[model samples]
Target: MRRIPILVTLLLVAACSQESERTYTVDELIADEALLSRTISDCRNNPGELRNTVNCHNAEAADGKLRLQNMRKALGG
Candidate 1:
């Protein structure tokens, strides 16, 4: 009986600890270039683990948007 209670408590603690972290939106990442760059670097460095994560997706989107904007500026558009 005591062992069962301890196991349940451990499971609860584990579940709380494993809660998903808040992910950044693409616009938010774009507005913060340093954060956007860091996120992209992290995702690229660990593609197997982060390729499908929300933050990675947002970071990639932000990067693409920034590149497009830069290209337009370079062409005087």
Candidate 2:
């Protein structure tokens, strides 16, 4: 009998805790700027060699830009 109420409460809690896409604050996004710079620098440094790594770094840089853009938009900037 008690299990039924406990289960219902747990389900309700879980449902309430479910989250959509996570949003970052402007300060949090800005903190990643250095990481983005490093990713860009890594790609630029190894232009011809390690094609896979260059591609990975390029992707990271692009993602970082998008994140910053989204953060700015969220912040009404």
Candidate 3:
């Protein structure tokens, strides 16, 4: 009786919680510099929590690729 209402309330609360954030791929992050910067900033700001996340990994990869590209361009290669 009372348990039914409690269960319903719990279900509603769980459903209203924040949805999981979608992760970006390395290529996607590379194509969006602003997003890449923001993601890197976020991962650095909360490293213990986000360092191992997919978004953080992709952001780091994208940053590496961009830096390598810049270096190549600078050397006229």
Candidate 4:
């Protein structure tokens, strides 16, 4: 009885803490752009292999693009 309640509470907390395709504010998107750029640039010289694919601007851009699109829609632009 008590254990079940505790388990349910834990599950609720975990779910709330998880991110679900949350959109970022414009400021956050801009900051992410800078960071992502730097990551790719560093990869160019270092050629970490993984860095090129990971930071060469695909995943982050896609995510940011979606968020920006959502923001634009929400703003009725």
Candidate 5:
């Protein structure tokens, strides 16, 4: 009976250590895709915000764009 309690505790500990998978919906996926698409482009007209797209005039604004592209590539977008 004491051994049974130890085994149960071990099982619980193993289960708790397991990792869970994360799933995202299609809308979420598409929204992310759009954001990524925008990042790959350079907005010639606008020199202010990165706006998810690349901007030569606003190189400083490209931080999010570069980040978004890297993130999309990592996420398999």
Candidate 6:
């Protein structure tokens, strides 16, 4: 089999692709907040942990915001 042209494939993908935005519901946002709070609480309760809960929480919040923004743009709202 022949290798696909990277640039051509990428162009085709971009041209035919639709931007899909995930819509977050109020409940989902609330759940994210709760999860973030729990992450903080976890770190607070234990000063030492392997996983970075705070970072994870922050990333989740950031991703949630991005998703919301994308969905808003998609809906033209």
Cα misplacement distance, residue 9 of candidate 3 (Å): 5.0
Q: For residue 35, give model 3's deviation from the true position in Å.
A: 0.3
Candidate 4 matches the true fold with a TM-score of 0.31
Model 6's TM-score against the true structure: 0.34
The TM-score of candidate 5 is 0.27
lDDT of 2 by residue, 1-77 (tens): 99999999999999999595333343443566665455556656886763466344454656667777899999999
The numbered model that scores best in lDDT is 3
lDDT of 6 by residue, 1-77 (tens): 24568778888999999985344444454557665555445555765661454454454565567679889999999
Clashes (candidate 2): 0
User: lDDT tens string, model 4, 1-77?
Assistant: 89999999999999889585333444454567665565546556666554545344454564567678889999999
Candidate lDDT scores, in order, read 0.93, 0.63, 0.97, 0.61, 0.52, 0.60
Clashing pairs in 1: none
RMSD of each: 2.9, 12.4, 2.1, 11.2, 14.6, 14.4
Please give the lDDT score at residue 73 for candidate 5.
100
| Candidate 1 per-residue C-alpha lDDT over 1-77 given as tens digits, one digit per residue, 9 for 90 to 100 | 89999999999999889668679999999999999999999999999999999999999889999999999999999
Tell me the lDDT of candidate 1: 0.93
Segments in model 2 whose C-alpha atoms lie over 4 Å from true places: 1-52
- How well is each residue in 1-77 modelled by candidate 5, as lDDT tens digits? 89999999999999999695233333343456554344335343443654443233233334456667789999999
- The TM-score measured for candidate 2 stands at 0.33
**Could you tell me how far off, in angstroms, the CA of residue 34 lies in candidate 1 after the best superposition?**
0.8
Candidate 1: which stretches are off by over 4 Å? Answer: 1-19
